[model samples]
Target: MTDTTGAGGPQDHESDGPTGPVIRDKRRIDPETGQVRDVSAEQVQETAAEQVAGGDNAFGGGVGDALPGGEQDPSGAPQATSGTPVDGGRSADDLHPDTVVAADRLEDLRRLQAEYVNYKRRVDRDRVRDREAGTTTVVEALLPVLDDLHMAKEHGELTEGPLLAIADKLETTLGRFGVERLGAVGETFDPAVHEALMHLPEADLPEGATETTIVQVMQPGFKVGDRVVRAARVAVADPA
Candidate 1:
């Protein structure tokens, strides 16, 4: 071997090899820009990595800046903040306040309406009960006079003297109050208003048919309005 050492590490010779040209690890020049590119690709990669790390440190890194209500970074990205954003030109809390108030008012109105209806119904029922009680009191007060009249009629003394006049006057007074007699003789007997004291069989009437004529009026009955204050006690005749 001949001495081949040159200035920069090694010198290239034509008889060095027949395979290919030898390339040296050294600085190169770009003919296009006429500037020297002294950096290797690995050095450029390391410098780019350092720049990325520095940028991440400045921006607080990752998804922290992108969160709502977060502090903003210098790169125009949103940062975390203590307060939340207002949406739709209003605060998030303010959006449902009116709806909540309206719902409460509606509930209050419904309760009031229900209470009013119940109060009306209660008042109506109480009024009806009070009227019935008053009518019952009036009818009860007239019972003694009716008993006297019935006793006089049964003794056949209803047609003479002041007793007849007194009974007529009492009946007239009761009639003004809607008091009517029930189960009179020769009238069809109704079980709703008449009580049969004795039932006798008579073959002159139709078979299985009931003779409802009041044969004897044992007690007088009275009604006020549509309600029977007293049921008539009578003897029903059955034709044989």
Candidate 2:
């Protein structure tokens, strides 16, 4: 039950059930007798203090998780030990001259891409407008021929013949290209669209009429879409 421990006096140790004999390294060499001595209380306390301060000596504890001073680090992450340079030792915002130049070139490339897109769109739009203008000009030039055809038809020269059929086909084909006739005798006169070639006296105006009215359409106008190619020439009757 009682045993000596190196330089320490006899101390009691309890039996750990029916197991084999336990061995303890409590002996040290005696200087005078040249024999082993029991360990002291002071040495036991020192060993315990060393184990608490340095963590588990027999089995590693908090080996890689802790810093040197046993104090909790602000961040448990390992500190950078090597002096590594980024972007050739330049700050992130103030990058190296070559890097800055490359970035500026990239920005210029982006700006050029945007400008090119805008220019292409403008060119496409102008091309469409030019095509429409060219079509409108050609159509306007043919108006005189159409007028002659109308006059001939009205005079009974193209009655139920190939000429009348050709004229009808021409008109229908032009309509498919957005060409439309403008002018009606009973409609109100608008100076923007109707050209008054003759005006009747106020006394000759129809009953209940107040504004200028188109009495006769001398020449029918032509238009394409919302654009007027030519104004309608008409005889107007003005009210008193």
In terms of TM-score, which candidate is strongest?
A: 2
RMSD of each: 13.7, 13.6
The TM-scores, one per candidate, come to 0.46, 0.51
Per-residue accuracy of model 1 over 64-158 as CA lDDT, tens digit each: 65566555578867743335556554545555778788989999999999999999999998887677667667878978878887887888878
lDDT of 2 at 130: 80
| Residue runs of model 1 more than 4 Å from their true location after superposition | 1-99, 150-180, 200-211, 224-227
Candidate 2: tens digits of C-alpha lDDT, residues 1-240: 777666555556775433444565544886679887878899789778978987675536674445433444357644332332335664355556897789999999999999999999999988877866776887788999889987896678988888888999989988877788877766788887889998876435556667888887778888876778998998888776
Alpha-carbon runs more than 4 Å astray in model 2: 1-90, 93-102, 156-159, 201-210, 225-227
Model 1 TM-score relative to the real fold: 0.46
